[model samples]
Target: MSTPLTVVCWNFENNGKGRPDLRAAGADLLRRLAPDIALRQELWDADAHGHKIFNEQTRALGLQGVLGAESCTAVFYNPAKFSVVRGWAQGRGPHFVLPPTALTLRYEDAGPDSLPFNAVSYHLNYASAEQRLLEAEWLTTWADKGWTTPGRSHHTLPAILAGDNNSYPTSSPGDLPLPDLNTVKNEPHRLHRSYAGPSGARLPDTRPDTAFRTAGLKDAALYWATAPHGDPSALSRTVNASHTHGPDSRVDRAYLTPELLAALTGFEVIEVDEALSDHHILRLTLNGDLLSDVLAPSMSA
Candidate 1:
């Protein structure tokens, strides 16, 4: 018998913008949520003080992890659930968080020869649809047999990418209505999430999410809500709707390839007291029986 694998993605408004950095609080919340994997963004100075901040946080969460080192993103996994393989960061800064990071790990109890999979933490450009499209293009490469990293070996492991995508998901028409471009409060969403149409009309650009889905990956929330055995109530926004801080939208997401999708068992948009983070948490659960099966293909190979 195998246990469930729980994963979470959060943009915890790091770096104290007119507010104090709640690194401690955020980790405590993650610990309570008890995800087997956690993806984080916007650590502001995550590598500050010789990585004191990040190290302390991960310690509190009881997970071993890796930092993008150059960007403000990180991927941490439960050491007991999987053994660490190698972690790497890709892309250049001034585009996305710390260049987007990934961690590879093979499941525990699997023999040394067992194949490992990867989990990625990424944050797309918040200012340009074109840039976001480019980011998605880079990410879609994972659906193929391998993804090339400039300075590393070809990464061929099955992987999942999750984080603050920052734009609405184009793959699914989520339960919330599209942001109103006409409203003054929605200017950011309009300017960032929409593309100019033929007659200068603003149309929501979904190329980012669409590219991932088109690459044959499943958007976890959408898949969970729509799958026959999934809970329909799980369909909702990833950001807190009641707050006027930004447009009500589901900007955070997790995308899984066929093997991981097959193991997916549960999904949730965890609403936390914003005193801890700006965005809600997205938690996904996968059946370890199915996950462990895919990680060891030699038996069938």
Candidate 2:
């Protein structure tokens, strides 16, 4: 049996003006959560400030951070528990906007025989729903082609993709009920662009949820639906109440492969007391024994 592993997904809203003391407070919030792995988005990497904040947060949490580029998106892991075997990025173009990041990670104590699994940190395009949908389709296709394993189809491993998806699941109980216009108008453009449109235009189908399902990826939050400890009320609360970007909208999400889903033990959306970021944090826990299963063949060989 393996111990439980904790993973967190958060978007720091690291851009904009008058956002006071965010770096320190964000680091502090992460430190408090102490996740084994963290997927972060909306990090402003155009300058040194973003890098500085990433570094500071990693130091405060005692985790090792990797940014595929200056800002885009980032992944951080506890060095004592895991190490990155390889890291890379995927995006729309050579200079893609907020490209997705991937890391192949192996458990530190699994010895030289350990097998690595892929962890992706993604932040879909925020300006246009059509663009975000395209990004999601590209991501699903990438997974279908075994991009994680590069040229080796048989070597493809299980993966977990988490970050600020910027769109809701199509299968969600109901449409993400929009917040009051007054509240949304003052918020960032990225938050409402997917759901809100011209006065008479119908809302676009912003379902990264459907795309992920079609790709054979499973929602971590849905794992609760079948577990013995699962609570429908709590699950509904977590899904409906869990808004990552704005207080009333849920844009952040995590998805896992069926293999990884088998190891899921717990999941929740953690509410932060302070205004560290406009988004809340998502937490996922899994059985560490899953790592052993993935590496068992190599160990025996």
Candidate 3:
């Protein structure tokens, strides 16, 4: 009997900025979704109010939340379903202001079939494409089995990395054109989303997402919807047009290691209520068979 595990990732736009009263609406929406795990970005002051709001909302939804760097990024899981074995934030300080919260979790009620799985909730740097690329490279280390922490602990587990990547994939969906940088009045976005082209023209920089694919991870959305040429309607854009001031594009994403990819059962982008968050939610579902098959010792005959 395989259990379906749902994972959702979202950038709650500074955890519902400018609408403090509506802050809990995001968690309320998440409660309706009933995700087993959630990866969040731009959760401004998640530890604020004496961790009152954050704790209350998450607990009400049966989620155990762990604050990441600057309390901006976080990972939440159902305590009854899983327990965090090892969790920490990576790429802090000069590298990324909101580092990815990485964790290895073990199934709670499983005996020997219990296997560790890795997950990361990341909000990549928004001011520099080069910096974001470096962050992507750092994430690939998990799939590469080269990840090590300051404590000298290492992990080589089937992993899921998700959140606001802050950039588009190397190839936009269906060869669809990205938003024109010339129209983007946001100076930081104009500078970060593109690099100089011929004669100093602006061109979209896709190296960040390319880095993850070049490694061993598969983007869950792309793998489920379409590999090379994706169906744009199916892989809907995540950004809110009003918020961007320019043509909005899909920026939120989720990636999985090979074994986990095989376990993916469903993937979707939920158009969240704008009152709750500006960015749509990216949801991925995988079967629990992954727990036992994640680390296959040898190739099948």
Candidate 4:
């Protein structure tokens, strides 16, 4: 059996005016949360200062940190719990504003042949729902291919794609309705053409929820909604909690492959000081034992 692994996915917001204080507050939150792995978005500066700040933060938490190109995204892991086997940034494409950072890690004490899983930290386009949908499709397609890729030295393992998805899980009744284009005076800036249905009819929901589900990924928070634990009432309250960005909607998320979905043990959207970030931090815990399962003989060989 393997130990439980706690992961946190957060959009730190761009490092700009008042960044010092925000970074400090974010670091403090990380210390308090103490996740085994942290998948971060919008670190925003690839310069020396960004590297220095990220390094310091991870060091303070006693974790190993890897920052992606242009400081777009990052991944920090507790070295005592897992060792990075391979790390790379996804290929840049038109739909992606920032390519995701991918890492494959093996438990520190596991045998050399033990299976290792992949974790991808991503940030989809926030300005356009159309762009966000296209990006989500690309991401899910990439994940499916990666998970099914052939002939690896080690066994195949599950994948966890987490970060600022900037969308909802589904068009559920509880979800905030998308404003009608005409109601908003056909404002060019506010209208999301991608959300329009056949013949340009406004969609009731604008989130890219279905696109992801069709790609074989499951929403972690949604999974917890049906299988409540701890305070049952809190499950609904926590899952529906809004305004990770300004006071309107919950956008940050973590999506897992079917294999990893079965191992999900806990999920939560944590609220923190707005000064720290406009977005809330998302936490997900999984049973590491399930992740250690190897692929069938044909694939493993």
Clashing pairs in 4: none
Clashes of each: 1, 1, 0, 0
Ranking by TM-score: 1, 3, 4, 2
lDDT of each: 0.74, 0.66, 0.74, 0.66
Tens digits of per-residue lDDT for model 1 on 84-126?
A: 7765554333444236877777788665666677788888878
Cα-based lDDT at residue 77, candidate 4:
90
lDDT of 2 by residue, 1-301 (tens): 4677889988777632224366667777778887899988776842375566557667878999787575778888998888887776543244346687778788765565555677888888766666776677666643542322332324446678887776665545532454433443434553445554568453534567778888898877766655688644223322233343333555677888776666687888787553456567888887777656654434322
Where does candidate 3 stray beyond 4 Å? 18-20, 90-94, 146-155, 172-176, 185-187, 197-200, 227-233, 242-244, 295-301
Colliding residue pairs in candidate 2: 244-279
**TM-score per model over all chains:** 0.87, 0.78, 0.86, 0.81
TM-score of model 1 relative to the true fold? 0.87
Distance from true location, Cα of 99 in model 1, Å: 1.5
As a TM-score, model 4 comes out at 0.81
- Per residue, candidate 4 scores C-alpha lDDT tens digits across 1-301 of 5678899988878853346766776777888888999998887653475477777777767899788777888888988888887776545355577777778876654455555677788887756777888777777754543333334443335678887765544645443444333444434434433356778865533456677788777777766655646222212321233322222454676777776666677787787666556677788876766545432324333
TM-score of 2: 0.78
Candidate closest to the true structure, highest TM-score: 1
Worst 10 residues of 4 by lDDT: 230-239
- TM-score of the candidate numbered 3? 0.86
